[model samples]
Target: MPRFSIVVPVYQVQGYLRACLESVLDQSYGDFELIVVDDCSPDGSPAILDEFAARDERVVPVHLPANGGIGPARNHGVRLARGEYLLFLDSDDSYTPGTLRAIAERIDATGRPDVVLFDYARTHWYGAVKRNRDAEVFGAAGAEVFTVAERPELLDLFTVVWNKAYRLDFFREGGFAFPTGFYEDAVVVYQTLWTARTITLVDRVCVYYRQRRRGNALRTPSREHFEVFAQYERLFRFIEERPELARWRGFLYDHMADHYLFILRQRDRVPPSSRPEFHRRAARDLRAHRPSGHRLGAHIPRTSFTLLSRAPYALYALHRVAAVKRAGLRRRHRVWRRRLRKVLLALHGRLVLRRALDPRLAVYSAFSHRGVLGDPAAIHRKAQEIAPHIRSVWVVGKDHVDALPPGVEHVLPGSRAYRRVTARATYLINNVNWANDLVKREGAVHIHTHQGTPLKSMGADLLKYPGARRGFSVPKMLRRADRWDYSLVANPHSELVWDRAYPCGFVSVRSGSPRNDCLVRPEPGRRESVRQRLGVPDDSTLILYAPTHRDHRQGGYAPTCDLERLVAGLPGDHVLAVRLHPSLARHHERGLGLRDLAERGLVLDVTDEPEVADLLLASDALITDYSSLMFDYAHLDRPVVLHTYDWDTYLAARGTYFDVTERPPGHVTRDEDELARLFASGAWCDEESTRLRSAFRARFGGYDDGRAAERVVRTLMLGEDMAAVPVVPAPGAPSDVLTRS
Candidate 1:
């Protein structure tokens, strides 16, 4: 018999099934058989399950003839399981890496408890994964082994069966079986907890309970949710049958009252049409099982509970009005706050800094108070190097004061000094625009050292694709561009695009980005140090996977590439470096952290690394999709593979200016398999890649001459005109590469 049998109930989860199966199949403790029960899904889940079983004999796919819900499907899997202990996993959800290994080790240490309760992460479709906050409950009062009577609070750790592992013999002997309907786990979980001979608790994240955008039973409202009433009735009946479990009555009644109130409050789960009937049924149950000493006063407000019990209609109407008023107040507060801040800042700019436009002062910001990094950092450092007389002050977040570079004077954004410098600086340099109301003094120069070369539509193009505008107005952007004294461009193509998209009077300088100067002339020591810090071998082929954010996605975009599978399919000597867009970095980190990738020895997360230049210097190849990094990375003439998995969807959502297929760089792979094949077949850096890179350079790599930083600093800070300076060939690029095809 296998040590553990993982029972997964599958329905319509085709999009996530592969990841779920891969997580299980790749577990560190792999001596387990996977039993996948297919409940006659209407989607392609059955074929997907069969495909997994064909690849790995350890996966057994059982197809049910009829469409049974999750409860029945799980029960079927349990009956077919042939292991000492059985673990239930939902088909849409997954186990974290090393979850089984940790569980098995803990169980062995405790001499095998009847059940082991573990924690779970609530993962959302928008790339947020949150851990359970009630971690103390899993501590079980500081004892490794405890009874439900000792710590009854574990019942509140989400009544989900998937977060726990059950011993097969013990479960069978208890005559445990799930009833057919929704909220079935509540009944089984409570019954097992109350009657288990031995219970153990592990305070580690073992499961990822996914919250899908659609199609979930919980998210979708129907009469089936009414089964919660029946499920609780079953629980109370089980408790009453066992006289030894009498102590749990008070807690159980309190839980029921709270759950009933929660259901009534959740308007989405319980429809308006069903509320009156649901409330009546709930009140009936509360009256029937009103335990002698049970009190809901401690769990919820006394007035609220009393109103819910005595006069629910009044409470319901009051809640509706309060919710609407709260929403309106929140929106009004945000609008008034922004307007007031803008008016005050404009006044400060016009009144206080009117006379402080010092020719020696330059203010720098990147990504809007993000940090002293990006193009702003590059230009700031270059200015300090070449123009010592120019005083440079960086605008940074107050929390990031300690991380500022040595000798650089900094002011927190919105401080008096920051407002004064921003208004009066003779030269204002930034990767993105300053605040919307920033008044540009007539003599003070505003230089737009734009963050990157655009592949997607920007500025005036937002008129065509309003969704891409997010919320900022096109007229506001045009006005902001009009204030620019100068704008930096990487190539003539960018000059044309920027001029058309953001029509303004600013002089467009055909100097490559200062950010790429470090890439053009890399320091050997810095490259070696970065490689060592990243734990990458010196001889390994480092492929950096850096994809762009999708405008269509909620909470921005996440990595579409199956990172674990991507790592597994690559050559052993090659390592993948992942860098997420700044917006989505934190979410992805919390969802699939770097420790797991590092433990696999397949990836190094350079998302938080100080400079993109550093990663560019260390990487031999780049994989991206519509990111401006492509233009910067092309300076190295290394191979680049465009992973355009959502090509059509992305184009439809946020239209691109150029067709990638027409003037492609390196090679393009539309899917994971194609990308993997390119790596495995060693076709990533072939002659075709070189030809495309050469063509890409001829169009986009003309302005970079390893002196863009010096040129920008001279024109803006040192008061030297770029037109007076002689144009030079890029130091490292081939001389024959020319612009305009």
Candidate 2:
């Protein structure tokens, strides 16, 4: 008998089915049968289901003649499952390799939890992920037997269903099914979690929830939020039915507040006049009080008086003025911003003629601006729009000699006296790590683009969480990144998140990197060409193991990869391309496991290489923990093995900004034995290989396309002819550390 039965609900999500099913079939822990119930989908989902059922005996596809939302379909599938443990997988999302294998072992070790809860993750724009780390242990209890009003964490059940695996006996005893028409998870989470006798939390991030952009499931939410009203009513009724939970009264207050936030968010769209009355009703009806605190206030205005009431065009204009002033956007070396804007306007007349000749014309947004002197991402991006034809600029100080763009003269070294750089060059840009200025208070056109990405609370939220001494100061960092004249941002939501975290400014929207953008595009055997260029063997699979360094004792985070087992377990043909994070790449530890592996000639360290992308492209897999580079590789369609040894502390320090169960690309492990077993057979099969490759590309896409450089050139430099501004020299700037004498 199969060890586990995966119950999948097939619905209208035919667009996302193939990859979803393949994820199940590819599990490194292969002892599982798939039970698929097609709830009469309107799309071509049925045809796909039929094809899958005929092709694989492990798959038992049930076709429901009529549509009965996700609940009934999952219920039908659960009934047909033959394994002792039941795993529910959404037809639109997927599972990582070794998910079931790990969970099954965990189930046995932890004494058969009614429900085994694991981390879940989701990707945005079908790209970057938002992760949540506090995935919990829940049990299988009747919906009417437990009340969520007491457990706020279970509220997350608001989003997903396939985030866990459960005991078939418990599920059978509880008689649980997705709620008929509304959210299935929401109806079950609280009841399930409350009934658990023993629940385990896997430190590893396991599932991948693919976010479908077009539909209004949650993005730009609507009246559907009100469904919670009925759901809560049922919860209240359930608790009343089961008098046992009267002791956890605190959950009641929390649920009331969660439900209140849900309702108030709904009323925000119904105009100000209707909102107050609606909120008043929420206060009187839901929580029995007036709404107060940071997010909402009837009397308080969102903007500052000096900027909001006095500035031109109010917010947008203030945003622009602040960007230019704070970031010092002009590329020309003129000390005065007014003079630089005038110079740029003079050059615009040239583009005006071209615009007249060709009506299809628009201004190009500058994607990068050196903002290291100040804000990390608030690098002034549209400097050309304000200083067209302006190029080469002077540094304010001396720290930035080698950081400037090629062909651009940085700063004359040994020049503490060059205070007034009125005639040197155009735009004195600051790279992200130069002279850090985080406050939005600085009136300069300094742009910022952060060096790395890991959203929740790593570097910026250092001080806020538990292990902050090793991280940077949050307020100071925000202020430094804030000093930029304008900002180059990834997405609007990112902007919103950043704005909420710091000060507001002009943001230049960007999709990806100006430098490493090549990773996202199909190399079309480019990896092979790159391998040849790098002088690596052609027949070997490559594994790039890179880890960041932190003060171990204080940091509480240590490398978790099983290097000896990994080296021993890897096929002789496979090469371990061990590249450590530059900061920690030094061979400081004399006899580290990885070092031993390298001594044995099983791996080679390439941490000092200028960029990791070329190596990543040529490689077959990556292994790391907490570094955001993994997200970038998600687009590469390669397998990844996570080695996060310090899982709890990392989450506590910086939150899991996204759901984890949905985003991990490969298996996550703690020691050498497990890692050895995984690579040995769990993931190397031909069918497993196809499943892994297909699931990866389905969510992340195939390539970077190499056009980003051209795009950047035309958009920010060459096409804009941004080469005529005079230099403004300052002493000791990183972007200006004495280039000229």
Candidate 3:
């Protein structure tokens, strides 16, 4: 028998069924059998399930005779389970990456508990993930394994069956089966906990319980919500049958009262016409199950419980209205306070702009104030080293300030201090343009450190492709560029491109790329350290698959290459590390199967990683499609493969400066089959690929020499002449090729 039997009850979840199945089938710990029960789904879920079963032998699909509810379908799956432990997952929900491995490790550590409970987060349809607020309940200290009585607070957790794993034998012995109807999980979850001989908590988020915007059975207006009362009745009956479990009577009573109030609050769940009867039934149950000398917790208001039991529906409605109004007033008061604070800050900033410039202050930002990263971060570090007199302050988004390195001072984009520093600072450096509203103060210098080489058409060059110029305004771009005192270019090609594209008055300096310095002169043991952190095996050939964002693609990222096919066809020693463009990172967690591949050790999702330079150092080769990262990777003399599956479409959508297809850095492949063949046949890093890379490097890799940051600091910040700055090393010089074990 397998270690785990994950039972998923499918209904009309055609949209989410595939993601859910992939989440299970792609687990890093593969010792699990997936039991997918199709409850006569009218939609396309059955076909999706059949497709998975045909491909993977581990997937076991069971078709029910008729359309049963979710509860009965789960019971059918459990009856067919043949694994040591039974776990349930809703067809619409999904397991987080490495969830099964984490649970298995926790089980072994806890000496095989009968039931292991783990935390779950709510993933909204609009791309927001929030962990359970009562996650602290799982943090009970002491023995690794214990009874429900040892940590009664676990009862406070959400009554969901999917968050916990039950030993198949223990569950079967207790005859724990979900009841048919709504709120069926409550009784089974509570009974399993109270009956289990041993219980343990994982204290980690194991599941992503998706909160759908529509088509949720419980969220719809229905009288089935009254089924909650029957579910609680079954729980109380089970407790009475086993007198030893009666200690939880008071807790159960309070839980029932809280759940009733919650249902009443959900206006969509309980209809307006049936609420009066629901309220009457709730009051009757409250009186009937009122445990003697049992007081509600301090966190819950006593008045609410009293009102639920004593008052009529009209009185309760009035109280709810008053409470809502008070809450709204408090929210409005907080909003006004925040607005007033912003107004005062703006006034103070305008006043500070009137003062003389601070020669010592330098403000830096990258990727339009997203974070302290890329060329701006490199220049900031270099300035502190050689130009100590200049105090550096990084401008970042408010949400990203915490990610800044320790001791690195930072200011939020719209804060008063950011405005003050931007106005009076002698040096303003950024890889991307600053806010359009920025005032170009005299005596202050603006240095536009271009982030990357222009493989694609940029700035005014994008005027030809209307799709590429979606939100771009050439007039506003030029106005921002007009404030620049200097434009740092990595090579002659970049200088020429910037001259035509930006058409600004700033002097273009061949200062090289500060970010690429790490590629040319990496710190000792840097490659090994980064690879170890990324969980790359010593024998593995790390292929960094960093793809560029497509302007024509709307909604979210659609992989240009068939990642699954490529991974499956490659050699076992070759590992694919995927780094999606920053613009697509937010959508990756939703539908992209990268997380599953990442958990399985076949792929690594390093999109959120701050430093792209570190990823470059960790990889043996790069596979890209029109990304400037290939230009930086060229300095390492590594093989670069261009996967131009959509070459014609991309050129039409977002025109490029040159034909990369004709002058690719290395071997080019238009499909995954050919891409896999190159890696399998060792052609990806062969002599022919290296020769192509050599010529490409000679053209674009001249400026980076491990001292670009130092040169930029000396010339721009320290007021040193270009002649005094370190000269670029001659062609065919010894380049640093990071060796892996």
Q: What are the lDDT scores of the predictions, listed in order? A: 0.81, 0.53, 0.85
Question: What is the TM-score ranking, best to worst?
Answer: 3, 1, 2
Model 3 segments beyond 4 Å from truth? 1-68, 76-166, 193-214, 236-258, 284-306, 327-342, 368-371, 397-403, 460-482, 500-505, 523-525, 528-542, 550-556, 560-609, 646-655, 726-741
* Model 1 CA lDDT for position 189: 91
Which tens-of-lDDT digit does each residue in 215-260 have in candidate 2?
6454443554445545655655566676775533345435555555
Using alpha carbons, what is the TM-score of model 1? 0.68
Error of 3 at 7 (Å): 6.0
List the pairs of residues colliding in candidate 3: none
Off by over 4 Å in 2: 133-159, 218-226, 267-433, 436-544, 547-741
Q: Which model is ahead, 1 or 3, in terms of TM-score?
A: 3
RMSD in Å for candidate 2, one decimal?
Answer: 20.9
Error of 2 at 357 (Å): 56
Model 1, residue 47: distance off in Å is: 15
Ten contiguous residues with the weakest lDDT in model 2: 358-367
Report the Cα lDDT for candidate 3. 0.85
